[model samples]
Target: MVNIVENIRKQIDDAVRNSVSKAVEAGELPEFEIEEVTVEIPKEKSHGDFSTNIAMQTARMAKKAPRQIAEIIVKNMDLEGTYIEKVEIAGPGFINFYLNNNWLYDSLKDIQRLREEYGRIDVGGGQKVMVEFVSANPTGPLHMGNARGGALGDCIASVLERAGYDVTREFYVNDAGNQIEKFGISLEARYLQLLKGEDAVEFPEDGYHGEDIIEHMKNYIEEHGDKLLDVDSSERRKALVEYALPKNVERIKKALEEYGVTFDVWFSEQSLYDSGEIEETLEYLKEKGYTREEDGALWFKATLFGAEKDEVIVRNNGVPTYFLADIAYHRNKFLKRNYDRVINLWGADHHGHVFRMKCGVEAFGIDPDKLDIVIFQLVRLYRNGEIARMSKRTGKSISLTDLLEEVGRDAARFFFNTKASGNHLDFDLDLAVKQSNENPVYYVQYAHARICSMLKVLESEGIKVPDVDEVNVSLLDKEEEIELLKKLAQYPEEIRLTAETLEPSRLTRYVYDVAAAFHSFYNACRVKGEEEEIMNARLILVDSTKIVIRNVLELLSINAPDKM
Candidate 1:
């Protein structure tokens, strides 16, 4: 059974093609024509679930008035045995298809069998994709802000994976940079104070001022006392700086895993320099003519290709800017691996950098479309209506670990899951922690638990559940029953749209929609066995609803508890 959207799109496409053929035969249109089939969801439910502008688009070439052409197209639409209950022409000749109930009822059973495979499509086909996100500088624990990017990247990857894209999740670690240097200097200050028993710790200028830095340094001193203290102050400081990069990275890694993120690749910035790839990429760019030099330093003439100004690749001091390493990282993701698509989930603070990066990629002659960037806006977490002003450098920022504990993983994921990725999100702890229906997480999970409770009770009474293929779905077509079935039927379209837009909120929202429908059905309708056949039919609907609920919850990495 094909999805309703795809099924209808095919028939509409065929109809439009036939309309064009008729016009061409009448010598009113060209022998061959080009047009896009527009199968869009209509804004007004009275119109139809989907509206197509195919007739309007073909009118120009066909030399027919748009409305006149629309009728010709609709007449050719082969709606036999298909779900279409009616097709209407409106708004300068758009074709809208309204589906019937049997199609909706049958969809519920198909979705149940598909479960994990539900809402999935081959929009990405077998194309290889790499999604790099939450790649914060590995110099501290992940802040609540950075954690937002992690959740988004991980969730988007999940969406793409479900859409049949061969997607790889990656984290780019900036381990060999200025931030790491500052991290070490701050830790060394505390280390010296503890080891030499100085009056107090004096943090270096431009160094970390976090309370965690002092604690991390204190731990280092207690374990390995004065090991580098024999060297000059500056030399020992450099040594501490070198050691603390790995130290901070290890801490960041533990926190990310604790926050429920698993990366298939954790790419290091230093590795680019070490493996000669950074130099290699620079030389490649130079050869390709996107470079320049001034004031005894090497620069890239990015402005020649529309950048605000040319950018420095290497300083007079011979150190490459962070920009150089990033160019190399993106090159490896695109040129070396030949991924069908490369997506970077970046924080909005770096929004200004989009042009220069895209310029550099296109300068290489690769398709610019292959590289997509999704920017995550800032997050403000409110506890009792007070704003949380937390930062990694100040140690005042809320850690992802603390968040998981306070709100629990299910709540945090659901809170993050509900909002659009690009919009600034407000995490209201008061609302999220509520145990009753006020909490969206509790509501969805509660629906799952109630169905499980009903199932367990039925099992205890020795009632048998229907197999998906054996489901007498036509028997489940009561008004409330078919309404729930319609929601289940929407899974494929939901997954397809989410994958197409690279937005997981659509999928997340659909989960809540289905849950609400189930809850309403639960309150209004009963499913018990004084009458076995009807009871079995209702059981199939509830069980299928449960499968759809668990499927979406898994995508968000939120659990669907069987019991409240």
Candidate 2:
């Protein structure tokens, strides 16, 4: 809740506005109304700590050159009771403010006082949000795509929660649809081939060909041999589906949980059908004149909602398409569950479905802007400096379980989130498992561990981290110490930005920066061997750094080890 950087930025903004007001009152400048003030961190260190373009923004209104206006504002500025150490006019009309180390000193106190809650901010205002991701089909194991989506979605949900949203992490179970039907066919054919003979039945070309399908049938035969051989094929397929679907769903659940993601809702796609919501949605669309019959099939006029053409909601055989089911599912999310916002994490293959789904939600009287779809690109796993297409265990596309087994939960999640969701990811298995600083997760975790080890050593020597009031934090004015404090102060702002952008990759980069700063501070300033007062001040700084690193790692669901 305590954002030191935001607090300082607001202070700077107010001081700048007041200076302009004072200038206007003194008749040194024309009287003009100021609507807003903008303040931001300077990209270069020489440009000062914070910069604003108020002079440029008000030039046309003030009827004066921007540089003249900037000089007048600086002359009238009062630096007392503020962190502004010096003000400079740079590059045409930009006003930059250099700060004393007060903000950095205050940040250490805030971190110590807030502890684990240091980075939390109330940007969401308790609005209800549902993040649905990794809704893989129940017929097969989760692949590399699911791995990336799981990490990104789960971390995003965590970021939202930290930003004070009432967030629900959900996994939509695609347990019913064309894929389930194909699953039944695959299981039935595999069952017959194992019992009757391979030549007795032909596997459908569109059926699933994963080894898990064959394993499911073999397990079923081992438990109950040929019990469905005499039954009708329809009944046999239903029995097989009933026996295998739950296991597959359960496997998916276990894999996700192992990958450090637990869904609050495992919403089943079949629930919409069984609850009659699908039928009701179709009827509602028909009543609204959005539907028509074409070639004996019921079609929804998708072009009205910006689609390329009309779409079939129900086929001529009376079976509903997945599109209809999807509409009903979103209707349930918005109208029934009453979430203020819903986010879906999907693979890039679903890019074309994004706008249509938004259109569908709009037809239900829901604001389409509330529906956010994050389409992440594919991930290609690499091992031994080569693309790894097959898992050593399954000899198939590498599963999430296989990825977890190969590197680890921390490395996998960290590496998957190292890039923006829009960029294609080449997961380096070799780099992920490395123990050196080349591995980012290792580097960050080592920073935390190094601090912990240092603290333990000092604790044995009867030198504990002192309270904020116990030491002079002004002693932490060294270059490396100031840079580390600046990084620590940016945590709350980082959380706010991550929530706004719905990007967990920001935190990954941020924590690495914090680690880098800590490493720099560790080498430049000696915490253990310094003078008593300086050592305690550095101890407090180091302790605060540990808290921030752990906080970010916890948000990403990665562990911070006490030893590396």
Candidate 3:
């Protein structure tokens, strides 16, 4: 849980604060309250390791030119017991601080001490978080949208766990809804069509047309025979639904498990109605005056909570709407389960639903702000420079299973996570399966494999990796060596920031950077033939990189192979 970079940043800020306080106390500058002093890492290395614009911030209150204030601050600065080697005023009032390599050495020590736990941080303060994703209808096969959402949601949960939140991965099963009704109708139609002629029963125009529906009925006929044919359509459809729903749910679970995702809760939508939570939620909303009747339908006053218009919670037919069930589901999440925060990963098609859902949660006497909905744009599959709409195996829409079969689970997860959720993703089939460095996942895994090979060779040569303290880390003065250490130092801070932003894609980008740094270091600095102390330090550095790279891959649920 040690963040050496943040520790150094705090020390730098403290030093600057002390310098400002001393100048004010000595009456060399007018007294003024400092609200916040920001210490930032400079993008350009030569500008210094850390930089602050404290003087510029104080210019108005000090009634002096920024450069003059900077001079006074620098003259009063005390650098004792700080990692700062020197401080300089650059470009009008920016105070640039150059540090001794001690902080870098300290980062190495932290990594060795914490090992796999190095990147962990406690920024979340043990808040309960539930991430619900990929609650695709249990009708047919899960499509590419579910695949992307699964990877993003699962990785986000992992990041939150590392950042110190009690995280739950949930999949809301739409087992009871209009979709299920349609599923039953579709299965009945397919079943009857198999026993009778295809033209004997008319398939509903809106019924599911996927081959899975046909297969489900075909299997049902084999197991149960044609007894269902004598029953009324309603009784037969109900029986067909009872038989097929479990299989569909099981298939969904198996597909997700194969894709490296497992849910803490497979929350069923029917549970809300069965447990009376939906009825209770409606009554609660009515008590809050958020519900009213219009056009013979029970309407929620969505406009009261910033929605563009009111929405129907219950139709005139007296059955609850999906919107109503969804509100109750969120109510169950907040009031019954009592999660401190709930995040939903949805497709961009749910854009309008987001506003009403937030309003619904707010009406449930909970803070709607705690409900975060990230609408990720859909993923389009491309193979050989053409859009791939049909799966070769399923002969229908490309499913999560099909994607896993073609690109591999590791590549699919890695590629899906390469972009932020807010952006559209074009998943390139050719690039994902590439074995060379052109593939990002292969490049990253190869870095790990390369290190494993190096470590093995060194071990066989009787050159073991020494402890961090046993080597003189100052021997790591080469540019590549320092760059690699600097990147290692960033992991902890990166974890914290990614958690704050709720963006798991940052972790992917970070590991890729670490891989690049390691590759650059491998090419420039020879770890084997160096003098004893330098070789030992580089060996420890390389080993530390392997740990971090593997840790990140594990978090993303992608395998880190010892050999690629």
Q: Which stretches in model 2 have alpha-carbon errors above 4 Å?
A: 19-36, 58-65, 72-80, 306-309
Clashing pairs for predicted structure model 2, backbone only: none
In angstroms, give how far residue 234 of model 2 lies from its true place.
Answer: 1.7
Evaluate model 1: give its lDDT: 0.78
- Candidate 3 lDDT over 293-366, as tens digits, reads 98899999999998889999899999999999999999989989999999999999998899899999888778
Winner on lDDT (1 vs 2):
2
Which ranges in model 1 have alpha carbons more than 4 Å from their true place?
A: 1-4, 22-32, 197-201, 233-235, 390-395
Question: Worst ten-residue run, lDDT, model 1?
Answer: 388-397
- The collision pairs in model 1 are 390-397, 391-397
Candidate that scores best on lDDT: 2
lDDT score, candidate 1, position 183: 72
lDDT of 1 by residue, 291-359 (tens): 888898889888877788888889988888888887888888888878889998888888988777887
The candidates, ranked best first by lDDT, are 2, 3, 1
Query: lDDT of each structure?
Result: 0.78, 0.93, 0.91
For 151-175, candidate 2 gives per-residue lDDT tens digits of 9999999999999999999989988
Instruction: TM-score each candidate.
Output: 0.93, 0.95, 0.95
